[model samples]
Target chain A: MKTVIIKYNAGNVSSVSFALERIGINALISENAEEIKSADKIIFPGVGEAGSAMNYLRQNKLDEVIHSLTQPILGICLGMQLMCNYSEEGKTNCLGIFDQNVKLFPLSELKVPQVGWNTITDLKTNLFSGIIENEYQYLVHSYYVELSAYTIAQTNYGISFSSALNKNNFYGVQFHPERSGAAGQKILENFIKL
Target chain B: MLSKRIISCLDIKDGRTVKGVNFENIIDAGDPVELAIAYAQQGIDELVFLDITASNEKRKILVDLVSRISRQVNIPFTVGGGISSVEDVSVLLNSGADKVSINSAAVKDPGLLKKMAGQFGSQCIVVAIDTKFENNDWWVYINGGQINTGIKAVDWAKKITELGAGEILLTSMNNDGTKKGFAVNITKQISEAVNIPVIASGGAGTMQHFKEIFISGKADAALAASIFHYKEIEVLELKKYLKNNNLEIRI
Candidate 1:
């Protein structure tokens, strides 16, 4: 199966490719619209500001290619945030795949960007197959998608939020499945099998 | 709920692990990649590779090592030591390092932190601060704790946070290498001062110390080097102990 990782100006594409490699899949990292459109699976990975990322996608015409893709697509971290309708970060608009809005966590006792490992609960969809409920996943982000109908998994950090989202062929996870240990690897494996 | 992180630090020199690691299953303890995989298998939440190599070719070697570790290990790791400029951070992060920690360089030119945080988001930029308690205050130290900057640790932590640091890896010079325990007082103070996560380093001797740093120290994570290198406390056992103690630890 041909798996292509959508690489724009975002970070963490190499790490995601390596994770796919560990799972025995040599995924291609590409920004070319034709290359990404022709893949069996596409993984959208990002770890940078939303506005700039969106600008890069638009400038390279990747935004149109991504919105028109019909294959199983997975978005991780900032990529997941950009999958929503809008993001509070940089007041940028994103792909309307999930119809969710990304908002920053309110300043409180808990840290802004909830770094380190956090548990994902209420697991649903094939993306979490072979993964247990409340399994730990590594995450690093300041903004989060509020709990919505598309939320496949939930995690609490001041409030309940969508740790993983699924709508049709599109899958998005706020955590880094590539960086998450064995359970995370399993999620990636399941995504591939899907 | 977010679980407290347990990180293992490996000192790298010329692309090799400095402190000899003796894991029973490890074939080449000198190899940082092998050692990193071992630690990840033992359920280590994160790993930090402090590259202490001072050669002109250090960047190339360090980047190669980072790429190797990223390919082999399926966990987040930070590459630090001798990273001063945006170019250094760019190569390391692009090479698959999850985060890059800046120590003395950040202190020398605080603008570097802002520039790094702006270029590469704050989440990927970790500011490592080494401090010592003197004159009834925890003062920031640089150059691997060889020079005291005379700035208060708490003040510096708050400054860095405002300057766009995603996390603070606070190491207590007094507590480091002591193995007695972490400096809970200063750790709590700094953790409270900053809005970001504080990774308390130094003075972690026992599993109880880990529990203390989380409970009393309010440290979001705890880092130790020698004790883990010496095999005095295993990562899995320590996590189980912390879990039993009612800490939100990933086991």
Candidate 2:
């Protein structure tokens, strides 16, 4: 199966590519529309500000291309947030693939920019197939998507939020599976099998 | 729930892992690639490689080492020591380092922090502040805690974050290798002063110390060298202890 990682003005592309390489799959990193569209599976991975990233996607017309991808697409971290309708990080209008809206972590006793590893519970999708219900995954994000009907996995930080989302061919995760060790590797392997 | 992090810091010298106290009494730990794989199997939250050598020749070794480790390990790794410019940050990031930490170089050129953040994004940039307690103030140190920058740790932390630093790795030189616990007051000050994530480094000998840092210091992560390197406290056991203490952890 062919996999293409949508590349733009974002970080962590190489790491995701490296993750795929570890699983014996060589993924093409491209920003070209035809290249991404032709792939059997598409992966949208990003680590950067929301507004500028969306601007880059729109500038290159990848925004529309991403929304129209019929094959399974996995978005990681900011990639997952950008797949939503809107983002509070930079007041960004995203691809609107999922019905959820990304908002900043509520300013409360809990810390902003939740870092380190956290266990994901209430997993309820095929993306989490074979993975335990409460497996630990690495995460680092200042903004998060509130729990909605599409939420596949839930995690609580200050308040509970969607740790993973599933909507048709589109799938997203707030945690970095590429960096979450064995459990993370299993998630990626499962995504690849899909 | 948010899980506490267990980070193992490897001080790299001539492309090898070295362990010591207060940045002295260097002893050979092992090969960087081998140790990194072991840590990955243990399910470490993160790995930090601090290049102790400060020469042009050693940096090339560090670069090659980073590339090898990035290929071998599937977790996030942060590289520090002698990172001076955007070019250096790019080289390390391109070599598979998830984040590039700026310590002495950032103090010398604060603009580099902004430049790196602009090029690689804020999440890839980490500002490591080495602080020493003096006159009841946490003062930033330079050159591996050899020179005092005279900059208060809290003030400098705010400055770096404003410059778009994604996180802060604050190390208390006085408490390092002492195994007493984290410098809670120093960690709390910096953690409260910045909106970004603060990682408390130094003075963790036991799993309880990790709990203390999270509860009392309010640090997002606790980074230690000896406790993890010498097997004094296993990362898995540490996570278990933190979870039992009402601290969220991945177990």
Candidate 3:
């Protein structure tokens, strides 16, 4: 099966491609709309800031291309944040695919970036088919999507937030499944099988 | 809940895992990539590969090693050692390293942390501070804990966070190689002073040490090298022990 990872000006795309390689899937990293549209499955992987990322997506018109894709597509970390309706980070508007807004975690005793491992619970989508509840996932993000109707999985860091979102064929995860261990690999496998 | 992380650090010299006692009397451990895979399978929360290779080919060798680990291992890892510029950080991150830890380079030029964080978000930038307790307060050191920077550890931790560091790797020169436990006092000082997560490094002898660092030290993560390399304590056992102690670990 053909899987295309949408290439943009974001970081960590290489790791996702490498993670796919470990699972025996040689996905193509391309920014070409034609290659992305023709793929049987599309993966939108991202790291870095939301404002500049949106600027890059809009400049290359990949925003429109992503909105038009019907294949099973996965958005990861910053890619998942970009799929929301809006983000408090840089006050930028997002792709609005999940009907949710990404928010910066409130200033508290806890760290800002929320680096390291956190558990993902309330799994309700095929993206986490075999993954057990309270499974630890690697997360490093300050912004999170609030628990919404589209939230497929939830995690708490002082307060509960959406760790994963799903709508139709679109899937989004705030954690890096590529960086997470075996549980994360299983999630990727389930996503591929879908 | 966000779990306290247990990170296994590998000192890479010429692409081989090497362990030095207090930065001296080096001993070869094993292949870094193989050790990394084993650590990942042991359910370690994260890995940090400190590139201690002091050759001109350090960058190339470290990059290749990082790419290999990223392909074979399925856990988050941070790469550090002699990274000074934005170009170095870009090269390592582009090569699939999840994070780049800056130690002496960040001390030499504090602006490096701000610039790197602005260019590539704060989450990916980790500032490693090597400090030793002296004259009634802990002071910062550079050049692998040989040269004292005369700066207070607490003040430096706060400064780096303001400069856009998302995490702090607080290594206690006094506690390192002691195998007594972590420097809980200074670790708690830095952890409470900074808004970013603090990773307690240097001294770790038992699973109880991990528990103390997480609970009393208030550290977000704990990192160790020798105990893990020599198989003094199995990672899975340590994790299970920490979990049994109710430390909220990933086991």
Best by lDDT: 1
What TM-score does chain B get in every candidate? Answer: 0.98, 0.94, 0.94
Q: Which ranges of candidate 2 are over 4 A from the true structure?
A: B20-29
Top-down lDDT ranking? 1, 3, 2
Model 3 scores what on Cα lDDT? Answer: 0.90
TM-score of decoy 3? 0.97
Listed models, DockQ each: 0.88, 0.57, 0.88
Fnat scores for every prediction: 0.85, 0.61, 0.90
Model 3 DockQ, alpha carbons vs. true complex: 0.88
| Model 1 lDDT tens row, A81-152 | 999999999999998889999999997756978898999999999999989988999999999999989999
Q: Best-fitting candidate, measured by TM-score?
A: 1
Clashes of 3: 0
Using DockQ as the yardstick, the better of models 1 and 2 is: 1
